[model samples]
Target chain A: MQDIYILFQVAGVGIIVAIIHTVLKQMGKEDIAHWATLIGFIIVLVIVIDYLSRLFNQIKSVFILQMIL
Target chain B: MGSILQLFVIIMVAAMLVIIVREQNESISFLLVLLLGIFVFLFVLNQVEQLFNLFQSIVSKFDVSLLHLDTMIKVIGVAYLTEFISQLLKDAQLNSVAVKVEIVGKLFILLLALPIFISVLETLMSFIPQ
Candidate 1:
């Protein structure tokens, strides 16, 4: 529910960044466009990485609980 | 689901038209087709999750360890995302870069699965009374 929403929000940012990069590249700003793409990727990675880390912790806790039980 | 089918048909028709137009020049038409594929794939992204859950449920019916299942799913995700990124790089004419990224992705996925592999092996070994 909320997770899907957050995921979509992050995906939307990625789409926007890609569009901007494409447009900039078309306008002959290859260097700037590439840098922008890199930044966009970093931003998306940061958001997704946080979620992944949380998921890893959840997986760890669940495994621990199962073992203890 | 019906809409996805419809979109696929539309893309097919568009591709046919592009082929016909190839006599003029294919560069822009090819780009359009590529964009069409991306847009359609994005539109049906939700269906993919349904497929993943279906796979998870089927896999869970087995006696396999959850750690192995999780590792497998993560590896599958990594493979899919790496392919997607590599394809995009290829589209941008960065084939070498795509190859490098794919290698890195494979290494990362291997690292992620190493722990699960070791645990499974140890569990199997202990079962043999060694």
Candidate 2:
């Protein structure tokens, strides 16, 4: 349920970051824009990594991976 | 019907958004696609679990070895995990890496099938003169 919102959240972050980058680029702050992009990427990564781990864990348990290992 | 329609709409909208934003930020668009992929998988997970439950019950009724069933299920899981990863790699323009991941996945499925393979070999060997 709550998981679905994560898609929109990532999308929002991406769009917002893009706007920020474009704005900074116009001001000739390429270095700051680069930093902003990196920070946005990290933020998205942080949000996604949590769900990815949980999904993998669920997959493992559902597949009875413990028995195989 | 309504839920399916809703899912379709959401997916369409999200895809369009990703396309529009892709020109702006590569990393973020990649993450957006990743999130969308995970969300859809999670959305259908309940139905898949139900199907597996039904499969387990039927297998139990037949007095079949649950170990083999477990291995088969795990192989399926490996396939799924690999596809998830390989697709992400491909999305990131790493086609060779994606292919390698797929190869590794096949190898893992083979490893998991070893016991079953041996069982078949033993059955065949028993049919020959000892």
Candidate 3:
């Protein structure tokens, strides 16, 4: 639902960042392109972590088992 | 909701492919192509819940214990995704790394299924009337 909107936004931002990085690299800006790639990955990872945390909380509430080994 | 999102992903990918095949700048177009593929992947993830529910229903129709089914699914998921990742690594020309990763994944999956194998052996022993 609302989460889908977040997903779309994250995907869109990632694509834009990739395009920027590619354009910069083609213009011989290797350093900036590398930084941009790192930033894009971090942004995507942040979204992933947020999504995983939400799922973890939901699963914890649903399952009372303390076995995580 | 999930299907609509999937439709959007397909459209974007198709557009990106068209752009890549006709475009002169292969590197930039390739990067865009990669971005589109990743974006579609991210979008398809929103359907994970639907997939889980469908799996749940299919598992319910079987006579197998739910926990066993879950474990089986977990192992399968790990194996299948590892295969995907290893292939991607190979495509990137990291064949040695991919081989190592595949070996590690196979070992992990074997370990994961150990309990099930042990339980089956125990059941067989009981039937032998030791």
lDDT of each: 0.60, 0.84, 0.59
Tell me which residue pairs clash in candidate 2: none
User: Which regions of candidate 3 deviate over 4 angstroms?
Assistant: A1-69, B1-48, B54-64
Q: Each candidate's chain A: what TM-score? A: 0.82, 0.91, 0.83
State the fraction of real interface contacts model 2 keeps. Answer: 0.72
**Which stretches of model 2 miss by more than 4 angstroms?**
A67-69, B62-67
Q: What is candidate 3's CA lDDT for residue B65?
A: 62
**DockQ of predictions, in order shown:** 0.05, 0.75, 0.12
Best first by TM-score, ranked: 2, 3, 1
lDDT of 1 by residue, A1-69 (tens): 124344344445555666787799899999998788677666756665565555434433332222311
Fraction of native A-B contacts kept, per candidate: 0.00, 0.72, 0.00
What is candidate 2's TM-score against the reference?
0.92
lDDT string for model 3 (A5-64, tens) is: 444454465567668877998999999998886777676666655665554444333322
Best by DockQ: 2
TM-score of chain B of each: 0.62, 0.91, 0.63
Say which prediction, candidate 1 or candidate 3, comes out ahead on DockQ. 3
lDDT of 3 by residue, B6-122 (tens): 668665755655364324333333333334444444454446546766777877887446667566655655665466558756655679999998998888778878999999998
Best model number under TM-score: 2
Candidate 3: residue pairs that collide: none
